[model samples]
Target: MKTYTYRHPEAIEHTGEVPVMDEQGQVILYSQRVYENYLKRTFDKMFDFRYFLKYEVLDSQREMLFTVKKISRRGKLWFEAVEVASKKKYIISYENWRIGLPTLFITDRKLKIQLEKEFEDWSNFLLDEVEIAKWKAEFSEELGEFHMTLQIHENSPIQQPEFFVGICQATLFVGA
Candidate 1:
């Protein structure tokens, strides 16, 4: 049994379970554990999570670089990342976010598949704070598709109001 109490003037609060899928329609990593801590074993302190973009389906075939963004909080405050691929090697360009602030574009590899590491930050780097369980990288040319999942804490200190508390169970598919 579940009850939903809506909160107004702030973030939307609901008690319904929805598939936490990414832009590519994949479930957010560790989201299962985030809800019940049953099927998957994550941290006990984890609460809620969401997948923002999940949009990685081979932007292009040729060697190219895209300035990426953090699509999901994944139990962290801020995050940003990009998947780089070329004829040679593949790379994942990423950024750990501070907040939901306006992020700038990375312009070094404007239009090339950087063989080596190709990411640089300005001044304040805080990657150590974000504790990620998995950051997958896809390099299979035969697949022609890439998949990514992000998990963020729904009841962290940075979260406002913090409505992701109480008894929770992850949403599941039902057949009729």
Candidate 2:
């Protein structure tokens, strides 16, 4: 299995670029700044308080793979990943968390697990990280398994993707 690290570049103007790196520290995919106007920034800070933003995930060739948008509605975080070519959207929204286990809804699927600890920093209400695993039944002929893990370096000091992580992860899971 190959490891992927999400990295944020060091600089004021370049901080918006979040790169997904391979084990060799090479960027495989990256998030591009879609819109960051002065009015949007000021408005978000003034009213929404950083509750909405948009970005694009591009491959190494800079072709758009997905358009990611995160918005807060009625105190719930809604993250959507839209495939550029197909326009298929995968959405994940925060549900009523129970006993420190976050309830996340991906369409009709509800995922409530402690493995999502790393993503807890995205909001103060979350308490765990997110990990994905694939399982197959020995007797089944039509089961597909898709597993992905994100590995970050200790020294890179990158900001967590927040709801963007769910958008990327859910897209990979549901889209694949």
Candidate 3:
């Protein structure tokens, strides 16, 4: 398995670049939260509300790999991630009414990826009833730092792991 870590400085407003590092602490990717409208972004930040935002994951060369956009349906929230090269779309939704740990479902045309929270800060990504990856998050309020780590199995079937990382970042940013 390969491990990747994402680290960023914690902030009240979630808008910045988060760097993803490999096991050797080499920067592998960067996830960036971008807001187009300054007024709207400021307003949302001031009110602690975020409805529309875009997140982009880029390679070390600064080439876009995938883009995630927050979308609303009725009163619930959803996220859509599109692979820039293939235009493949992944839809992620939250199960808000669950009794225990929050769950998220990431679906595409061919696969349905389920992230089942096993503990307060750990989750397992399952594909076809098999554990493909593990996710763990750590937060340090005192130091104002946040970290997300992913352990991906060598045999994992997911083609675009960056998309999953981007979705995870989006979930954290939106506090979902």
Candidate 4:
């Protein structure tokens, strides 16, 4: 087998955004795209909160789903109505209620699992058993594909360099 090296004469330089052609010779991908800045200001306002939040929507009538939810509970409660949409959906139409407990289990052991299970059990409660199964299947797929950037801002903050930038790429292709 012949080994290829990038700088050697044996290797071909990769031009950015190589065009992929179908059988009909139609261009499938190009370096250029018509980027519409429409609603960017509106979108920016949505993210105007001090805390960072974003989500990549996998599917819907909306091209990309974006929402900022402020969690509120009526009073001290085990469970609160965070969201209930379409009369049968757990979509984030409301805020997730939570106790003022640290996410990290520094002083509490059951807090993490309890919080997770809260959402899990709540999911079942929101939908019928059959609908829950189907919604979970689709939502799980979306969950796997859904990638978001989040940074927990610290009130007592310190400057830190980004560690992942210019590091590497790991390919994960499990399909034929």
Name the candidate that leads on lDDT: 3
TM-score of 3: 0.88
Worst 10 residues of 1 by lDDT: 167-176
Model 2 residue 78 distance off true place after TM-score fit, in angstroms: 1.5
Order by lDDT, highest first: 3, 2, 1, 4
Instruction: Report lDDT per candidate.
Output: 0.23, 0.45, 0.78, 0.18
Counting clashing residue pairs in each candidate, in order, gives 11, 7, 0, 0
TM-score of each: 0.19, 0.54, 0.88, 0.19
Give the CA lDDT, 0 to 100, for residue 18 in model 3: 78
Model 3 lDDT tens row, 76-175: 7788989899998899887862365657788987888888764356788888888889887788778788768888887788745587688777776555
lDDT (tens digit, per residue) of candidate 1 on 41-144: 23312423232211121212212232222233454422233334322222223333333322222222332211111112211111233321112222234554
Per-residue alpha-carbon lDDT of candidate 2 for residues 65-84, written as tens digits (9 for 90 to 100):
77776665675566675667
Candidate 2 lDDT score at position 61:
85
The TM-score, computed over Cα atoms with residue i paired to residue i, of candidate 1 is 0.19
Candidate 1 lDDT score at position 164: 17
